[model samples]
Target: MSAESLTPTETLVLLTLLAEARPVSNTELKTLGPELRAASRRKLTRLGLVATDTSVRPFTHELTDDGWARCRTLLGADTPPRVAPPVRAVYTLLRALGRHLDRADLQLYEVFAPATEEVAPVDDTSPTVEGRIRAAYRELAREPGAWVGLARLRSALADLPVDEVDRELVRMNRLPDVHLNPEMNQKALGDHDRAAAVVVGDTPNHLLSIEVA
Candidate 1:
């Protein structure tokens, strides 16, 4: 992968291989934890920065010769970057609403597509969709002190198709008291708007819980 495209863990894997200077067993790469190291190794392999030493029973991996050069380049970069914090879709909507924009809600809604973000899994034995949502909400959201993870909640109440949950969550966002994805990208509502906006995660803000007013 391009240096810029590497995820943190992937970068670490490259760096680790550079440091070890020899093939390391997958078990040994567990210095960064097995799950993450394995995942990073997979990505690194795809990018041609790492290769598996299949000569052994269990596979081991190490950086390629080019991988060493990539590491050197990353280490040599000395320029400081001028970058702004990423902007999130929900926060963008929040700012528009704060400004009382005529069609801000509609405009922002078009992007997040929370209505179709996820579809609940099917299970005929569970309660009705609405009933499940209500029950899950009550149990998990006596108050949104801690955000209930969307995926976790989805699994908790997976009887309905995920799209049904997404639709309800989108509708729920309309409530003044409820804040879907309230832990939004931080930014000033007025002024300080930037020339460009970038979304960081695939769906970092998707998981949500309600908050008390």
Candidate 2:
């Protein structure tokens, strides 16, 4: 199927797999972020975009040819291989896929685009959870209509109890400008440094996001 035929979540999973030139374990996939859940992956597999090797305990996966073709078309790349290796790969082939594509830029175009409205300059490097939460809301909620990812919000609130942050987002939903989504989006995650923060060093299937735009 074409890019238009896939859901936003499905598209994201495919792109993540496409970023990896080698077979990535589902465990490593989880390290990418929370949106790559088993259900989303299963749906992608059913659609013939991703292949899984369940023979191992933690199954490994890669993009199928059709999946690569679709992702390349969406990415507007004419390269021979449709998928690129993770940024950590030493091989040059994977870097070629990244030649024209940036994870953030692709995320905005094919997945979720952040608001263009300029935000009031707010210092988000607060030490406390409350301060961090306040800063995160300010950072993520500058526009009247836009969406931000949970992974981003957490990065903004670094070192806080993730669950507490979740509660805070839900609490803010009562306000007119704020909304909380339990739905997970992994697009902004996994630039190598984010691996440790993934579920506090464990794979987290449940992801939550807040919108203040």
Highest lDDT scorer: 2
Residue range with the least summed lDDT across 10 consecutive positions in model 1:
193-202
Off by over 4 Å in 2: 1-4, 76-213
lDDT of each: 0.50, 0.52
* Candidate 1 lDDT, 1-213, residue by residue in tens: 355476545655665665555567777777643333556657777777788876895677866645755654553343234322232332343344435423443222223222233333434456565446546765776565455555556667656665676655645544433344522444532121121111111122433554441
Over 1-213, each residue of candidate 2 has an lDDT whose tens digit, in order, gives: 534465545665666665554467867777874356677777778877778888997888877656766665554433334344432232243345455456533321222212232323335564545457655655775553345556666777667776787545533433434443323456745553343232310123223333432
Please report how far candidate 1 places residue 55 from its true position, in Å.
4.9
Kindly report which residue stretches of model 1 are placed more than 4 angstroms away from their true locations once superposed: 1-4, 32-39, 78-213
TM-score of each: 0.33, 0.34
- Residue 98 of model 1 has an lDDT of 38
